[model samples]
Target chain A: MAKFSGVWATFEYLDEMSHAVEKIREKGKKPTVLSPCPRHEIDHALGEPQTRLPFISLFAGMLGCLTGYSFTAWTASDWVLPVSGKPIVAIPPFTIIGFELTILFTALFTLAGMVLLGVIDTLRHPLPPAVKKYTRFQRDRFGVVVDCDPAQTQDFEEIFKSYGAEEVHIENN
Target chain B: MSGTTFTYGKINDDMLRMLERPHPSYFLLLLGFLTALGLGVLSLAVQVNVGIGYSGINHPIAWGVYITNFVFWIGIGHAGTLISAVFYLTRAPWRTAIYRAAEAMTVFAVMTAGLFPLLHTGRPWLAYWLIPYPNQRMLWVNFKSPLAWDVFAVSTYMTVSILFFMIGLIPDIAILRDEAIRKGQKLRAMIFTPLSLFWRGTNYQWMHYMRAYLIYAAIATPLVFSVHSIVSWDFAMSSIPGWHTTIFAPYFVAGAIFSGLAMVMTVLIPVRVVFGLEDYITDHVVQSVCRVIIFTSIIVGYAYATEFFIGWYSGSPFEKAIFYFRPFGLMEEWTLTGEQSIGFPQIAFFLMVFCNVIAPIPLWRWKIRNNLVAVWIICGLINVGMWFERFNIVGSSLQREFLPAAWGSYWPTVVEFGITVGSFGFFFTLFSLFVKALPPMAIMELKEAAHPPMKKEAHG
Candidate 1:
């Protein structure tokens, strides 16, 4: 993650996250770039692709509509006999319940999906040393982590410096 | 004391401190509540022991006190939506001081309004039968009936009101959560717990919340228009001469808002003074609302003329005679109260016109509109006049409904009169309590009112 920060990384380093895999191939270590609400072409820069939300919400909403409509219709028709000549399964009357249930399920599922996605409810992320040093991501600084702790003496710094690296902050993970 | 300086938020804190202790204002309010509550208790006792006959609703007008109070309180409820949404949209700064109380007024007045149709029902226990649900009795209510429409209209309106109120309370609940953490206040935390719903104040949560609230507001806009339109349709759909008119949908909506704004102005002027919120609720806000008042005043005037023209143009003898009887028909033939009935009850006629139409003309002239004294008096007149308009429309119209044999009248009985006043007390009592518990304004809106929009966020 530190390998993807902008503040810790130089212009050449910015190009590393921009052209993340290229630098990763150069470094002999692969890296992944992330975009929740994309800054723009960041995914394209990293060559990763994705789509919005789960198809499950649409299915849930459809199911809810059918359930609501059928319940209202059944109750009016089969469950009780008509006193007058009025139709037992009046679709117009059941439309209200159907519409309300559709919106309700869509809203409920979207909220559940966000929680499951770990968007904001990051309750227990332990702070790694490198991530702690780069907590400036919370504010204005955007720098990419090179994944090399530098403490490893893993020769990663040499590989990073080769990519026009301005400065390297070791991530103590 | 008359010309002292104070901060806006500071006034609430100071008032709270005084209120927490034994202050004169607190004692006065408490006394007022107790007195009104006593009246309510006594009235309820009579109502429970006796019957609906205790009310002034009899003969030609089977709806009197309860209905009058119903319109009055529902009109009161209108002011809340205006304060919360309308004034917010218009950038009325004065809304800060009064919006919360007005919303509270909305909830309590709705409660009061909900009671009327039930109270009007002689056997109140059978009221739940109005809900169109399956039952063992194998009975179904008429879906086409206006009363059924009223049931749906009121139910939908109340639901929307509650949603609007709860959404507005979310940020304030967060504020309380923060305060509770700082002070380790048990009561504060308990109140905030459910309302906060584990809000983390994260940017994502705020974005979602903002989107939901905006969607609800957009949804509520039409609900506000339709709910009142349906309520008005209750009368217009009927065959009661003056009540039956195509103009009513708009006319009733206009009248409701017209009366609603006047009520807001009256309530705010005194409230701003007591709460010392002059800076936030400035003369500009009053004038802004008065602008709406003036526009609607003209519409109401046009409605009056349009009704008369409609009667004359259509040449419906019944409609024509109803209008003619209002101002010129013989007293021997047409009945009204007292010798005042002789030449049209000029008092009732002029009172409605003067208050609804004429009282707001000075608003077109900027100086008088902005003048606090003049504006307050006019607001008072508007309140009086709007009530009289309803009385004339409901009372006078129903009193004569085309059939001479069914042409008796109405006056409020003691129980009916007491309950009406009690409802006012109920509304204000809730409003006062809300002021102490919550930030009276939408803080975000107030902040926006002070500043311009921010640039869109970029994750980078």
Candidate 2:
């Protein structure tokens, strides 16, 4: 892994944080933004790609519906036991199980997708030095950590300060 | 929005402090519940050893307090999903503060409810027979049976609710991890880190997280409605007089939401006081919840009247006899040997009316709805009324059948009563532990609701 040095800046306001992200991106640096809550404006500014979770859940739910219905029908037919004189492959009642499993599988797959696509993204990228240095980003403060050469640290700090950053920390690792 | 004075930092700190600092009273209350839970476990062990006969269920009333408790708890499970999923989809901002605990209640109530069928089955060891997996003997579960439907419904409901609850917890757990690292609590940080899944609040992660949460919420809404409806069908599918009504599905769903909301209040009232969460879970939330209670109570009241009307309108002598016996209990002239002229069923009918319908009428007034004590008392009463409502529906109808010779009444044995109390103990113990372990509020969602990001404003 190529070790990149970075400077992280904390801003009290979302606007200031977004302005700082725009500035760093203008300099051809990828800035990692840490926020207390999700912001639509920040996502637009960062140009974050849309996730595939919805499509994944849709396919998973359909499979679940199939699995649920077929499981009941196949098992009943395998046994060849008629219940209360009803047909072995009862579709109407089996639909309830199918419906429940559809939701269950959809939810399970969505969580799995979230872990695979969302959380893993964070794990794949190194933790921002700022997150380790200043804990406020997890609570109230909005922050941006920009990866850069050690020689460019001062320039990034100045860009951050001009955008109303309350504090700046440089980490070279 | 008018009442929200919290900043993101303040909300995070307030919730985190509760998890970090345990109150003396919390342990005291938990100890009381744990002791009750221990007694309940002892009762269950005795019942298992002695056989299902140790319960109040007898020949005619094969489904007694155990089934009643099952339906009651499952019904209570409904409100949590209603608040968390249904309200979330409807964009009800007030739910942001209360939904976490409500979701927890749903998951726990379902767990508690899931136990009853196995407990009622005499041969609980054969509970796996309920599953329809392929086997060597080629025995499959009865797909047409409502009891089998319940296994699928309750299990799926539990599965979906737990997933929804855990997904919602991730962001808050990440916040806890960050706080733990800051506070030098290495052990807590180590525990929270992996659970948080390395959430860094990046927009990419939020994008996926938001969409997944919306999908879960969408599915959970219908799942909650279905679980309770299936529970009601367990009675309605039968040919027995009171259980044969077609209105059972909607009636049970409404009653379940009503009771579940009441349980949320019963639990949250004490929780807010103990945790000092008055700011987040305010009187507005209480009033909003009470309004829902009143609406459902009316539906429940209508169902009650409609059930009697249907019984009369159907003109079946058996239906009329059961309805009449429910309230008036076989007039003295027609009393059979071993049958009381008027019994506990009669008393249960009136009590159900008073608690489920008549008692909540006071909630229409702002004074009663907003008053914490009054809200708590009424919710407690509704919880009681709903349980009796299930009891009356299950026990009374079973006690009298088409053949008068087969009719018999049921009164729960000591073991059955102990187990019922113990289920409550188990529920509260899980809830009490949850409050202490995790952030009871959705800290991130609350901040989003309270102070949403401005659309047009930009940096100067």
Candidate 3:
């Protein structure tokens, strides 16, 4: 009997990999699909919820707009040195500043949100040693990791092999 | 191999191989650019030590080649964003193979453009005074000025462009890292490991990455227009006869994309041949850029016609006088030097017309656009024309001011020419290193656009 933490399956074909993922879900087990590139089919097979990254960008953009406008206006009013007979707080020109800040904050926040989510997921489920050993997931192969009892590793391996997985192995942590 | 048969392994093998050590000729190219940049630095040092008078700029023409180059480089950056962000949003398939290099161009071009202002100010160290920072002096920048708007617009554009470019490179860098690790190259792995940001290509990473990338495209699309619009406002907001026109914003935006696309082709065509990336950057990609140049050329031509019409129709003597001076101001006495020579304005105006409006027309013919040699020549001419376009806008108008007494023909000195050539050196040197250092093509996105390797062929 083999003592293992999980089972890893690698596939060269997107269709085979996606089908294997569907089978894992049908067996009431969660599996994470890995690939060199994002696939619409794999995304559909995973059935994950829509990402909330946009809301993060939107909120930050609004905050940035307020900050840009208020900062310019506050600094302008602080010195009341009117020039060219224009108002102390001009809205038209300041709108350009506000618009630029809105984009700047939106892009930065979106990137930060992505890094944060990636880090959180990485912390929760550290990559297995086998993943480090076999890096095809970052190059060409599509991979799925299924956690199961040590005794059931064979069963998962059989399921993966049946769905055209090129390699199946028991990953010990 | 055929396009449909391109597998993931082949894509990796092809792109990552570019990262290997380059030929000695690559270093020679880099050295050439560095030499140019050194000359520019020396000229700038001399100017700073002596005075700003080393350049052609004076009382009437306070803005000269530096401002022209500033606008030219900024305009050159626009097409990169347009290609990367705008094409992405539109789902243009051809963009995948080219967007990575284009985005890199945008960042480098903007960085090159940013240097002009610092150089022009003479006191580059005190350039921070333009920023709206809290200080003991309590001197706030005048918010009403277009120059103030430029500080925010350009800085924000630079920051956002860099972020966008870095985000796009994440997946590609991950591939490079993993390849290095697999090959047991300790040093390369060490360098790329952190740059990849620990991307393991999990479903979660892809989901969030795709969403965020789309949002970045959305935000950057507007910047493609706004940045150049703000740049044009530096001239438009002025009450000068030729600069104060409502058409300046759109006209400048169109010209920016036009010149930017030309520059992309100008670089990419040679790169494709030298790198032997004929499969990736194909004739189809070159043709697409040529078509865009044709469309933009028409808009630029129309804008030229409209400027002349408005000058004649508005009945403003100053506008008509400046418009006349642009193409017909050959009077030797009109020059500040008072030498018996042709003025720079007329020469630049006609050359601008010949290169920008006339040269690109042949691209409309499929045969000409497909010919790489012809396309390359046309692109080069467009670049030259766009620079003159800026020169015409900045120089000609300032030369023929409302009061002829205040008008002067600005002649560029060797130092100004050196600095101008040096800016190109700076851009090319950074870009030349970038091509060897990073994946010039978007590896992951190219795979996405291609057929996925399958047990069986599945076509969408």
What would the per-residue lDDT of candidate 3 be over residues B315-353, giving only the tens digit for each residue?
A: 999999999889988454455555656777777898999
> For residues B111-221, what per-residue lDDT tens digits would candidate 2 score against the true structure?
999899999998899898888766888787887789898988888898888888988998899898888899898998899889987777876678888998889889998
**Candidate 2 deviant stretches above 4 angstroms:** A25-30, A83-85, A148-155, B333-342, B452-460
Q: What are the RMSDs of all candidates, in order? A: 8.8, 2.7, 2.3
The full ranking of all candidates by DockQ, starting with the best, is 3, 2, 1
Evaluate candidate 1 and give its CAPRI docking class based on DockQ.
Answer: incorrect
What is the C-alpha lDDT profile of model 3 across A1-173, one tens digit per residue?
22338898899899989888988889888787789999888977887647778889999999889988998899889988867697888898889888989998998899999999877766655556677668788889998988787887888999999999998888764
Best by lDDT: 3
User: Can you give the DockQ of every candidate in the order shown?
Assistant: 0.07, 0.61, 0.78
Worst 10 residues of 3 chain B by lDDT: B330-339
* lDDT agreement of model 3 with the native: 0.89
* Regions of model 1 farther than 4 Å from truth: A1-173, B1-23, B86-99, B327-348, B451-460
Please list, in the order the candidates appear, how each scores on TM-score for chain B only: 0.87, 0.96, 0.97
Where model 3 places Cα greater than 4 Å from the true spot, the runs are: A1-4, B330-339, B457-460
C-alpha TM-score for every candidate: 0.72, 0.94, 0.97
